[model samples]
Target chain A: MIEIILGKYNYWIYIALMMIGFYAMIAKENLVKKILGMNIFQTGVILLYVSISKVSGGTVPIIWDKGGPYDNPLPHVLMLTAIVVSVSTTAVALALIVRIYKSYGTIEDDQIVVINSHDGDKEIPSEKASTII
Target chain B: MIELLDILLLLFLVICAVAAISMRDLLSSTIVLGSYSLFMAVVWTRLNAVDVAFTEASVGAGITTMLMLAALSRTKRFEFLYRKKGQQEDPNKETNPLLKNWKRKRFSVTKVSGLIVVLLTGAILIYGTMDMPDFGDPNSPSYTHVATMYIERGQPEVNVPNLVTAVLASYRGYDTLGETIVIFTAGIGVILMLRKRKKT
Candidate 1:
């Protein structure tokens, strides 16, 4: 039983990470914190796909002087794309946060609402928002 | 056995998930979530998917946490929980920001809608999985028809061991090009979101 469990430890870890990321994203109140949670969540999915591709006793993809078959390389390339996408999402999220801060003078969702409700400013379009930025 | 260990690890994952969701402090939850991602990286390694494992370690554990922290920095740390006794003292105090419409608050249509969405997604996923081959079965149709060629001829075509990459980037180069385009679009989105607009 122990041997069997050991064999699949990686999958367990993947599932655990996914749950934690999901929980954080759902539970967090802070916008920044939520973004952090989202990051974890996305990463969890990436890890899951990578783990699923691994094979035992596999060698690196590089063909060495020994001339032997090695592990697959497909996951690596796909992951590269995923990393880039995650970074882009992060950049956009941070920018949104900055804009929110500038307009409301606070980052809290509740506070922003209170401020906006009090202020006479209507829903500013993206065009107007960027102009102020 | 490996199976037992897998079960235990799965259990640990479940516990961490529960803690992450139930925890009161959102910041701590986010950090815990990061830990979860790191552990997942280890899982990927054990599965023998080295490439996937590496990406997970870097992107999942590294990039995601960074983004969450960035977003969190700009928002409130806590949800204001309402106290029953305090509300009686000041009727004007709107403790529940969501209490705008008594009817909506009494029966959260949004929550109901979210549940419906979750259920529909779950049903679709379950249905899709029914047609999928069992994990790691070499005899599956997926292996026999499409994957076999790549496994057999991949070395000569691309000089790469990882058939997955060969199929993704080289054979289906068009798809890869599309992915590049998608990334470019995402980058553009980030730029647009962050760009400073000129004053009138």
Candidate 2:
């Protein structure tokens, strides 16, 4: 009964995490909050994949004379690449944010749209507006 | 039977996701997202698909969150709500007080359509999952093919116990290179979008 409960618990946890992230992304008005939610959602995917890779009583991927079989190593390698890629992307995204902040004095989405659409004739460049600021 | 550790890890993922979304601050969300990705990377370790896990950890959790935060910093921190009370006067229409120099416009249909498209794509993904194989079964066709090949001859061919790495870096080296190119393209796109033009 304990084992069954534990198994059910794990399943529910994964589902809960997935839902939380999804809800946050959908409901949050704060741009940063949405991004955070996205992170949560992606993490959920990672958890699901990792959980699926386990083999009961399996040794680490390293082979030894006493071992029956080794745990799979493919997931680890994939994850390493993923980590590196995520960091690189983060760096670029942060750079873009800096640029955005420079251009728009305000980070409120509706305000920016209001400012941009006010020009009924000539198009105003975001850079130009920021320069004026 | 799986170990207790697996259950705990899954629980952790749930907690992080819930907290990340529930939190009011965007910065905290991004950070939680990063943690979420790192945890997912660990999950990849548990699953035998080390390569997929690596991609998820790096691209999904790491780069994606960073990109999102950067986008937020440039864009509006808060979404605007429309006001209805003050438009009664023909000559005294209330221009936006917040953006004194700018004009205000209502939300467009394009944005709504774009959102609908996103919802449809998500629905498709959920539907696709129904046809997938149930977890890890040695008798499954996927297990018998390339997955089994790696399990059987991975040590001999690449001398690496991690079959995913061997396959990604060696047998499917070209594919990995292509993936790298795609990432490069994304970087280029962000750069292009943000590039400042010099005034003549």
Candidate 2, residue B157: the lDDT equals 91
lDDT of 1 by residue, B1-200 (tens): 23456556556655656655555566676677667666666655555555565666676667766766765665545433333543433223334443443221222344355445545644554454444443443454543554446556777889865665676678876767877787687678767876789888
Which digits, one per residue and each the tens of the lDDT, describe model 2 over residues B98-166?
465443345445445545654564566445544544444344354455555666677689876556667
Clashes of 1: 35
Residue B27's C-alpha lDDT in candidate 2?
60
Error of 1 at B38 (Å): 1.0
Q: State which docking tier applies to candidate 2.
A: acceptable
lDDT at A112, model 1? 54
Per-candidate local distance difference test: 0.57, 0.55
Which candidate comes out best when scored by TM-score? Answer: 1
Per residue, candidate 1 scores C-alpha lDDT tens digits across A22-133 of 5445544345655655665666566545543443444455444555434445555566677667666766777788777666545445445555566676665688779899
Clash statistics: count for each candidate: 35, 31
